[model samples]
Target: MQDFNGQIAFITGGASGAGLGQAQVFGRAGARIVIADVRAEAIETALAALAGEGITAHGIVLDIMDREAYARAADEVEQVFGAPPTLLFNTAGVNSFGPVEKTTYADFDWIVGVNLGGVINGMVTFVPRMIAAGKPGHIVTVSSMGGLQGSAIAAPYSAAKAAVVNLMESYRAGLAQYGIGVSVVCPANIKTNIAEASRLRPAQFAGSGYVENEASIASLHSIHAHGMEPIELAEHVKAAIEQNQLYVIPYPEAKEQLRRHYDEIVDAVLPMEADPEGARKRTEALRNWAADRARVFQKSEG
Candidate 1:
């Protein structure tokens, strides 16, 4: 995973933003780029931009939610470029702002379908092929800082991103034995068209029931307006891949917050009062409850 030259990369949502930034970095490193996006025009535009940079690239129209389309895109890349792509980026995502109580079923479905399900689809379709090829490769899943911490206002986005973060962790642990590296990016804020480019809410959620309230939307917009450049975050991703790092955190300030949060958890665990009888009873009850819960939850999938 250290070297990318002459390798092939398949990037979802590569038409713009951080996805395009990753594509640019890979291309600059002499990698063959396959930019997949739902917007045909945007893909063409990205192709033109890459071409202008003298990069070898191709554009494939892809809606990551469509499993068939994802498979076909992977097949096409292999047919044209030889072996399966070595670098796979699951970067397509959307944002929803609002309170959890106001959120509707459709809102949850759309966000989860695009963010979490899309990442799952990409991994399923590409990881096995890469492992079979027996080549060094990396899977980069673009999660958000919101994924790391539950943001009160953006419940749907936070839920989806949290799922992505955990999924990447599981994927990394599972793939490590196969020599396939995985990196999960927890970006705090980066300048992108996420808000403007987000898909419209379904009619079922559009009126009042939508999770994103006006205040929260305004807050997100303000943050977006002041976010980092996409390329800067992309460089961080490239550096993480080069270093074989599992977590790629782009914002330094946000890292401090994360560190503080972890410290608080550690502190909370360290100050235990001596209470043998109470502790034993509590532990046994907790273990029993967990055992019961696991039996019921065993059949469910994340």
Candidate 2:
């Protein structure tokens, strides 16, 4: 929506990084901010920072992987704000890097739980409420540039983020009927602390933490420390939300990378003879199958 004035924004991972950036921008635009994060100390700091700027903000300690906790947080948001949030941000995420074969199951769980599960939990908990409110709203899920391409070292992170991209596409198609806009942000590197995500790994996943790749980790940290400012990315997100844009990519180089990746996939597909009749028959069969399986979303605006 063009107007964010008086809207309530519920942002996961809002304590820091890109989420915090969004809070800053949306708050300046007159939206009440709700910062949900697992780190209690960080939440305190973020809330204070917002308060210093005269932005109305609330903080809730949240671990997005816990579905019960998410439900409670939603209740708390409504309790505090007197209504459900209209702007939802599924931006909480973490990163880990290692050889694919060497990565442990715990690694998969930890990475997937925070990156992909966080987005799913946010959608499951908030989308229905936003729908019921029958007000214009928007959902933004932060994937990554890596999600658009594969990486040998960060396979788990890439896989989880890639799934987020696909999930948001489905939500966009379904939620459009209700006028709830959806945007999947695939941002490139930015100045954030995500490189140090291993610090918060649960005890259960300790053994699966980043392998002995200090040099690589150091290189990545250096890049992230000097990357684009969060406020710049925040500006892009604001514009995207205003325009109801589906994809938000702030980095210039990422476009070329996406092009190459998609080009490779397109080139790799096996070619067959062009047959209009055969294609029409296949299309009809697909439609029948979708109808039979109840795989299509059918909803009409009132």
What TM-score fits each model? Answer: 0.84, 0.93
lDDT of each: 0.84, 0.90
Write the residue-wise lDDT of candidate 1 on 1-302 in tens digits.
66788999999989998889988988998999999988898999999999999999999998788899889988999999999988999998888766777776777778888889899999999998999999888999999998887776778789899999899989888898788889999888877778754444445434545535556566667878788787888888889998889999867788688988778888776334667778889889999998988787776733
**Model 1 segments beyond 4 Å from truth?**
199-208, 211-222, 268-302
Query: Model 2, 1-302: lDDT tens per residue?
Result: 99998999999989999999999999999999999999999999999999999999999999999999999999999999988899999989999888887888899999998999888889999999999999999999999998988888888999999999999999999899899999999888889888768878888776774563557568778989987787789899999999999999988877787888899999986555557678779889999998866644343321
RMSD per prediction, one decimal?
5.3, 2.5
Q: Which residue pairs come into collision in candidate 1?
A: 97-212, 98-211, 98-212, 98-213
- Minimal lDDT window, size 10, model 2: 293-302
Ten contiguous residues with the weakest lDDT in model 1: 197-206
lDDT of 1 at 253: 83
Q: Per model, state how many residue pairs clash.
A: 4, 0
Instruction: In model 1, state the lDDT of residue 239.
Output: 91
Model 1 deviation from the true structure expressed as Cα RMSD, one decimal place? 5.3
Mark the regions of model 2 whose C-alpha exceeds 4 Å error after superposition: 212-218, 270-277, 290-302
